[model samples]
Target: MTVQLSGRLQAIADLVTCRAVLADVGTDHAHLPVWLCETGKIKSAIAMDVRKGPLLRAETSVRLAGLEDRIQLRLSDGLEQLRAGEADSIVIAGMGGILIRTILQKCPDRAASAKELILGPQSDPDQVRRQAQNLHFRIDREDFIREDGKYYPLIHLIPGEEEAAYAEEELFFGPCLLRDRNPVLKEYLLRRMRTTGQILEGLKKHSTESSRRRAEELGKEKRLLEAALNRYEM
Candidate 1:
């Protein structure tokens, strides 16, 4: 069975440290697990989701791939269905950063038991990075991908002693990703540059304290984009 993943999630999948059993949280359609199985990278995987419809969709894919025995389909909310050490690694993708942080925070034990975590947050990436730091999960790698005119952030985190405090710039623009900036990453930075320029322009017409703060933020973002472009590959 050949499984296809969105370019962003495919990048995230590439960062996963393959283990005996992988659990994909919010496994919509279970494409990642199916891909791992087809590639023989993992012995088994659990495709878990909070919604039944998606779980059913994953079920269909598992059956189509003749992997029902190897892939387990479960209706689970966050990590509720996951017990400690159920899998060597966990992947939470295609979700917002806040929700992903909540899932990890609520199931610290479960997260701690896993050897690693691969997260691909669609939004609030800075928030996710901050929460990961707070949780003592060291980020081993970060990858950037753009698909369908949107940028995605993939982080590879694992258990370990806390490292040096991360700077605000590191949180907003990943250190690894910014340094290794590929063509897609360059495009993403350019998009952010344009967006921040627009925001700064809008602030000029709005005369208020909030507008002033926004203008300041836009300035910071513009500088960050420039630094990223200068320091990273184009």
Candidate 2:
């Protein structure tokens, strides 16, 4: 059976190392693992979700994909149900950045087992990047995609921290994406610069201490984003 993934999931799938055994956290309908297995990108997979409802649905999808033997479905919170070294790659997608950070932080053992981690954090990607560094996993590559009017940043991190790859602003955006000069990211930066400018303008109307401080912060952010965008001009 052929499984077509949405743009966001497809972007995340593209980051998975070829032929890697998979552990898909927040598997939801288990679309990714099933598609990967069907396409021969993976030999086996464990599709996990925190909710029984999703796990059951995943079970049905796996059964229909005729991958019941290759794909196992589990009800797991984060990586809690996964054992160390059980899989070659771990994927946690469609989650808030903070929760993804928490999952990695809470399951160092499980995380250490994988050769790669494919993460797609819905928000606060900077925090996710910082946490990955704290876990000693440097980004192998990264991508930013716009799906349905929202932006999703994908990070592929492998165990070990290396020298600085990009400017510290990557913590605010992404290292590989910045290095690649991804046009989608350029679009996102422009939109954010406009938003920050608008907020700063509103903050200027109020001269309270907090307003002033917020304006200062936004001003800095505006400048940083502009600098990142400037690289695209070169």
Candidate 3:
């Protein structure tokens, strides 16, 4: 039986360009790796998760897929147990952006050795992009998908010289996504605009210094979102 992945997970898997070996970090059910191997997209895979329960689930999935020989399961915290040059590409998905950033930070050398990175952070994508930039990974591609009333951003990064700089808007809204004028990105921005507007409305009720300061900051953010939205028109 072919393994089916959710839309978000499929988006993450589609970003995997490395055919030799791919490492799936925090692979809860090992679905991605099994799918990749079953489809002949990758020669081998190392499915690593921090928790034993999830790792066992991944193992079961791998075995059910009849990919026991091609996929290796491991329990690792981040990339601590992974060595440099072990895999051609690494995927860290379905985790908070801060935790994803921490994983990359904790294993800079190992991360740098890989040819590419496919990241899908559940939150704070800006932090993930900023950290990737600092680590000299160029943002190659970014795609947005709206699944089950949630927007998910998938980023593809490759080793390269550090980018010169990124505008605040570019950092928050992915640089490639903005440049490409992705329609889904516009949808994501519109949702943020609405949320921020609601926050601003709530802040207006209170005139304290802290509330006032927060209002000012959010006001700037709203303006930026408006400007970004405007780009779609022109």
Query: Residue-wise lDDT of candidate 3 within 62-155, one digit each (tens)?
Result: 8888899999998999998899999999999888999999999999998999999999988888899999987889999998888999888889
Candidate 2, residues 22-107: lDDT per residue as tens digits? Answer: 99999988999999999888999999999999998898889888998999888888999999999999999898999999998999
Predicted model with the maximum TM-score: 3
TM-score of structure candidate 2: 0.94
Number of the candidate with higher TM-score, 1 or 3 = 3
lDDT, ranked from best to worst: 3, 2, 1
Residue-level lDDT tens digits of model 1 in 52-111: 999989998898899999999889999989999999889998889989989988898888
Q: Cα deviation in Å at residue 61, candidate 2?
A: 0.9
Q: Number of clashes in every candidate structure?
A: 0, 0, 0
- For lDDT, the strongest prediction is 3
Model 3 clash pairs? none
Per-residue error (Å), model 3, residue 214: 2.9
Give all TM-scores, in the order shown: 0.90, 0.94, 0.95
Model 1 / residue 100 / CA error / Å: 0.8
